[model samples]
Target: MTERIWKIGTRGSLLAMTQTRMVQELLAEIGVRSEAVILHTRGDQLKDKPLWKFGGKAVFVTEFEEKILSGEIDMAVHSAKDMPAKTPEGLVIGACLPRENPADVLVVRRGNDFFGGGGKEKRGEKKADPASGPRIGTSSLRREMQLREQFGLENVSPLRGNVPTRLEKLRTGQYDGVILAAAGLARLELDHEPDLVYHSMDAARYLPAAGQGIIAVECRKGGATEALLRHLNDRRTEVELAAERGFMYGIAAGCHEPVAAHAVLGEDGTLRMRVMKYGNGRCRYFSGEAPESRCALLAEELAGQVLAALRPAEEEEDHRTGSRRKDG
Candidate 1:
């Protein structure tokens, strides 16, 4: 009897292909044969514009998703952060691979003294010029807002490209520094660049985007591919992703919303989650913990609280505007 080879769909980018190949290797270890089917997505084609301008992060997954729905592919691998808050109907995340470090990292060019002294400041060291702040490159509004509000960086510029291309830009001194996901740098083994200085952000202070650093395998609900993927799912990662994604959906956040959520499962079977929403030049945060079994509910409750807090401020602003109009 001949064995069947499953087709795993993935984006054409090096990072996407590398992640998909990791899944393929896992399947191979389990005695399942699989092959990578590279698919170029809309996000890949429209590199000149920001993602939100077209269709947000979903643009990256739509083509692979269509192929899966049409039965052209058995499953698709995706960077979990690139997925929308809500899964499309008829498809489900069958597996979430073990997560990598989710913290964001600042990658500074070799000669840039933005940090004053080798990615850190020394006592009495002169700070960089405030009028001409270092040009930091990033594509995410979440990161950009955090950079400005949290770190006081004022010269952030939009940078769009794959991981390697971004690195190339940094190498050429196109920008003084760039912000990138630590997980991607680790996976690509690009973190050891002698010409770059790395400063990792604290995940607690700088919350990661929901589902960041996770590799998700999406398959048709209740399909054979789903069954096969179950073996690869990391239970802890699945639970964490559930809580984080639950909060995202509860808030009705789109892919490009300046929102972040991260869930951690403790050894004591408790799930703790932190969520942040950045807007109007300010940031709102909500955090909660619950038994792992009830993590989803806790996330929903926290999201509701966040929304409730936001409504009063919005209503007050509207009321003041209306009163001024009537008086005029």
Candidate 2:
């Protein structure tokens, strides 16, 4: 006798479907049966408005989660970056897969995948670079501000849609280049195609959007999915993601706030954190190291210091803007 095939709920996007398919294949290899149940989420419907306008980080996960609570789906699969630091009611994130590059990359039109590598995009090879002539598109204010503040590139701005859509925009010259998760391009198997060129960034020089390349497996709290996910969980990724998200969540980072953080395991196995915050046409950074075992505490402390450092100036600017609004 075989167990019933479990159905996993996910957003109905190409990358979402691809990732869910991978999970199903992984389960099949273990002799467990599973299927993908696609759902259209509110965040999926409104691509033009920056996410922060409507609840920030949790917007993408809210609809699917409602179904999980209703028993319409047994589980939900999400990009770890989109999940909030605090668990939603009656739900738990049961697994964090081993992370991919977790670094952001700059992508150009499909014609540039191999300018320097003999047309072979290696494990770390990029699909494009941020050359001066190409107009780069990035959906994140965090990416845009940093690219300008730190990289001196003046053309980057917000562009919406999933991986393929963004790539199409780039291909059509809506942008000479765009920024996307390096992990996303690889996960969808579009990384090595000969027609595209992209540049993966150095994390030390560029702090990545929080939890950029990890996936979160969510299920009803204390449910069977929890028991199953425990098997697929990667312990180190779990700790690192938790700490990075802890920092972002601590500062109450919303889509509009423009924040980024990346936690990496040092050679000594401790967690080293890099954080970024953007406001009023300026960007600032924070860094720290802690024992991986004490990640949560360290993340909280660092988040406070970063925010405190920026808040005073931000508030004064806010006050000035409010005064102008009143005068108008």
Candidate 3:
């Protein structure tokens, strides 16, 4: 009997290719041979445009999903973070590989002060003013707001491109610092660049994108492809991802919305999650934890809690403003 050969679909970007290769290797270990098929997605064509300006994160996975459904590829491998909250009908995430370090990291220009605001200090201590901080670059609105609110960094600019391009920009002095996923730098072996200094941000303070650092293999609802992909699923990663995606679904978050969520499975079998949402010129945080089996429900519950809390505050503010207007 001959082993089945699978065609794995992935984007052409270096990071995407790297992740795809990892999936291929995992399959090979299980005696399942596979070949990589590079697909140029709308996200790739519009690299220069901000994701929010056009199709949100959907642009990244749309073509690949189409290919899978059309049977052009047996499976699609993607960075889980790129996937949206809802899967198209007839498609399902067959597996989520073990996640990498989900924390965000700061890569600073070699000769510049590593921290944006001169150096790290107590929250309210004498520190370098925001005006004098080095310019930091990132595309995430969540990161931008967190930087300003938590680190007092006000000079963040929009940065687009893959990991290498972003690093090249920093190397050429296009910006003094850039924030990137630690897992990406590690996967590409770019974490040790001598020209840059690395600082791991605290996850509680710097919430990452939902499903960050995870590699996912998606397939149609039920078939040989999905059955084969079942071998690749990591239970812990799937549970954490379920919680994160459930929260995203609950909130109806689009790529443009300044929203971020991170979930982790602890040794005690508890799945804990932290989520952040920016609205009306302010940021709000929500958190919850539950057993792995109930992770998704826990996430949805937290989402409801956040919405319930926000509506009244918004109504009261509107009422106060209206009353002041009438008195004046």
| Top candidate by lDDT | 1
* Top candidate by TM-score: 1
Question: Residue-wise lDDT of candidate 2 within 1-328, one digit each (tens)?
Answer: 7668888998889999888887777677777788888888788888987777777768888887888889888888889888877778788888878889888887754554322353323222222453543467876777877766655566566787889888888777788777888899999987775667767888777788788888888899896878887788888888888898899879987766678888988769889888888865677788899997789988999889987898898899989999999999
For each candidate, the alpha-carbon lDDT, in order, equals: 0.88, 0.79, 0.86
Candidate 1 per-residue lDDT, tens place, 275-299, comes to 8997445888888899988998999
Q: What value does the lDDT take at residue 66 in candidate 3?
A: 94
lDDT by residue for model 3 over 1-328, one digit each (tens)?
9767899999898999999999999889988889999998888888787888888888889899999999999889988888999899999999999999998998887677557454455221224676556778898888888888877677788899999999999889888888899999999999998878888899877899998889989999898888988998998999888889999999888878888899989999998889998866778999988988788789999889878877888788899999999999
Q: For model 2, what is the alpha-carbon lDDT of residue 51?
A: 73
For model 1 the TM-score comes to 0.93
Q: Per-residue error at 12 for model 3, in Å?
A: 0.7
TM-scores, all candidates, are 0.93, 0.87, 0.91
lDDT score for residue 317 of model 2? 90
List candidate 2 segments past 4 Å from native: 110-133, 318-328
314, model 3: CA deviation in Å? 4.9
- Residue pairs whose backbone atoms clash in candidate 1: none
By lDDT, is 2 or 3 better? Answer: 3
Q: Give the C-alpha miss distance for residue 151 in model 1, angstroms.
A: 1.1
